[model samples]
Target: MDQNEIQFSYRARDDRGVFEVVPRVDGTPLTDLIDKFETDAGMRPSGDAYGGLVPQFFRFGPMEDHFHGRLGDAKTPLLGCECGEWGCWPLLARITTTDDLVIWDAFEQPHRPARDYTGFGPFRFDRHRYDDALGKLSRAVDEGS
Candidate 1:
């Protein structure tokens, strides 16, 4: 570990390896953990990787089903919203291993050791950060070729 590469931390549901075997938090063994995390956090997964588990956290009996902003404009980045609502949202992570997790923000900025998010959970990750991370991953994959 370099003295400079900060340890970005967050409290994810730790579903990195159960994609093919484990059942979801509910009886539905088919729910995608990612989608569950997003829906529960009141956000949307930025990828086409949802649809199966997009309803467990939703589908309540019409309490004015409000729609949070979607990731509009494929060419643009949708970082945190202008709304000030906060909660225990899940932090999306690109984990290298069980002990090596990186929580990225929409701007591609990782958590700093000196970060003072004293009220938020381990961290609060959103879509824009995921897009930035996807960009980084694409670059790495391209370079490896």
Candidate 2:
């Protein structure tokens, strides 16, 4: 989802360099980022949808658990709600450090002209573990069949 006014890149490992928890001011709104996370990445909310758990553009715990269970490793850079709740709150996240830090970028609602928030280092993950998980995620996104 490349736009003339915005640029997007991500590094799931330590070398990816996600040091700060600030919004990218390249003229792209937060909702567009979340849309990429959902449409391009295929990350969806994983609870009972009829129970008020709709598919979220950015879901932390479920994505973490999915990768963790498959890889049998615990190192990941992406972190989510500390209280373990799921919703379309986080717009995007990046691993700041190898395994003990991440910057969670979020928005109050998935709309423009809305309040936004940033969280620094909420979840921890190992670099290699993150790599493995990312590989799987990328494959899932690329090979949707």
Candidate 3:
């Protein structure tokens, strides 16, 4: 199967004084991608209710036992509420990694379990490239840029 390229970029809302790093898949914002899927599925767009998680939570890799509670086995919180509280609204996905690939699939809206996100993604990425993008994000965060 073909893989999607993943990249991380920062967005700053000067009016709200909010700065965050957002994930982009295949050159489009991941949020927009999800919105497109929801729209196509005849569901209401999530709009501003959700946003990317804070930089610190992006520890992308194989699923582990350490991920419990709101993040069940193989799942990680990818996007969270714009209000800065993750539990309020989150877009979670099962993330699994192989030696050369990272896969994100089985998306869920914990707050709205009835909403099915079955066809949204099973996005695959080259491990090396994904790691490089993550490294860039880490450096940018450390530099406060």
Pairs clashing in candidate 2? Answer: 75-126, 76-125, 76-126, 99-125
Mind giving the per-residue lDDT tens digits that candidate 2 earns over 1-145? 2212211122222332221111222454333444453444333542221111111323333433433333243332222222222232323233244353222333233322233333221333444645554555445433432
Off by over 4 Å in 3: 55-73
Native-to-model Cα distance after best TM-score fit, residue 145 in candidate 3, in Å: 8.1
Per-residue lDDT over 6-93 for candidate 1, one digit per residue giving the tens place of the 0 to 100 score: 2111112234311111112222321243344445544433222322211123232211111111222111111111121111122222
List TM-scores for all candidates, in order. Answer: 0.18, 0.27, 0.81
Candidate 1 segments exceeding 4 Å error = 1-121
Tens digits of per-residue lDDT, candidate 3, 18-133, equal 56656799999887888778777777646666776554444433222212223445577777777655567778888776789888889998777899988888899998888778
For each candidate, the alpha-carbon lDDT, in order, equals 0.25, 0.31, 0.70
TM-score of 2: 0.27
Q: Whole-model lDDT, candidate 2?
A: 0.31
Better candidate number, 1 or 2, judged by lDDT: 2
Positional deviation of residue 13's Cα in model 2 after best superposition, in angstroms: 28
